[model samples]
Target: MSNIGNYIKLLRESKNYSQRKLSLISKVSNATINRVESGISMPDPDTLKKLAPALGASYEKFMAIAGYLTGENSANNHNYTTGGNLLLKEEMEAIDLISHIKDKNLRTWITDPSSIDYIVFAKKLSDMGIDPDFVYNEFVSRIMKKNRE
Candidate 1:
């Protein structure tokens, strides 16, 4: 759904800030913050500027998440080989794929980074001559099949 909204919520929660507190610190209204969290709206660049520092995250990260700029434009973004959140792009795809897992119980582990071995996943995909994207689609397809059963 809304990566930006999910990212904002993740940032806010990591800081242990309540919506009311974030609103006060960022000068963003509580209602606006709530709406953004609910995925009902996206914040403007100005709002992002205020919120990023308040949340202790980089503005470029938020702007890139918001689609204001492509991730490639930001030096702080995850590099293919290394940097912060080494699995972010892959993990994000995994998160998107989990929505297809209709059995709510089975979906629980998808968001847990520790549950996956990204190195093995990548190596196996490569060894199989499979594209990472293909595995993502296949995982979702398998989940959909379960839903149909």
Candidate 2:
């Protein structure tokens, strides 16, 4: 299955939202939603962003879905918990950090289960000056530490 389809499925299931319900919430046509979910059509960035919030997800999530659709699994999985509050600053910082990492391998590792401490990961990226290789190594190191703990 294409990444877009996988993501659409994941987000839809996670939120317990039907495609028609998501269509209504996103103001997108149900056919469009179905097309995206089925990998028949890829939505533009703007349309994807609009649908994300309705799925109770963020733009990053939509980007991940896009990446998945493109057969690229370079999506960050930062399990950020703000307790129903959106931390705009932190989110922006994270977006900046992710943008800096141009390597797909590094990005995939950073977003994988092995490197889930998003706050620490972001801080490390900031401190290390956004070097993808360094960030990848640090992510591995952090994962090892967590496993040992």
Candidate 3:
């Protein structure tokens, strides 16, 4: 099977979703999901867009994996997490605070310090007396709005 197909299958199983369940939630046909997972076909941008949220991943990440993006652009687009010495103390603290959130996409975005979402999230957390839960909810709201656009 193709690398992207394996990646999707791993993520789907991690979420405990069957192919039919993923299809139902993602609004992609079961045949499409089967084709993707079986490495019979590659998903296009629109298909990946539909599947991303349902699979708890970002469309850019899927795009990168599907070879839709290339070179430095792909590196810039994908939200690959940087850890260890790369994380600032505030970033570490923010990650810890957000650990309770169940949204995998949000968690992935927040973990990548280079992501604009993480920058905005870190700035919000720096505000005195600001509630972490409120920040998380706001980010969730923003993500929902973005997905609609």
Best by lDDT: 3
lDDT of 3 by residue, 77-132 (tens): 45533331222335434433554557777655544435635564557676766776
Q: RMSD to native for every prediction?
A: 10.3, 11.4, 11.6
Global local distance difference test of model 2 = 0.60
Question: Can you tell me which runs of candidate 1 are displaced by over 4 Å?
Answer: 71-88, 94-149
Higher-scoring candidate on TM-score, 1 or 3: 1
Please give, for residues 1-149, the per-residue lDDT of candidate 1 as tens digits: 47777667655665667999999999999998888877899889999999988987667656666777664555455332223443355545554455445653454343333444554476568878988777878989999999999
Question: Which sections of candidate 2 miss by over 4 Å?
Answer: 68-149
Between candidates 1 and 2, the lDDT winner: 1
lDDT of 1: 0.67
Per-residue C-alpha lDDT of model 2 across residues 20-92, encoded as one tens digit per residue: 8888888988998888777788878888778877866567556654643233333223322333332333443
TM-score attained by model 3: 0.53
In candidate 2, how many Å is residue 83 off? 13
For each candidate in the order shown, give its overall lDDT on alpha carbons. Answer: 0.67, 0.60, 0.68
Indicate whether candidate 1 or candidate 2 has the larger TM-score: 1
TM-score of predicted structure 1: 0.55
Error of 1 at 39 (Å): 0.8
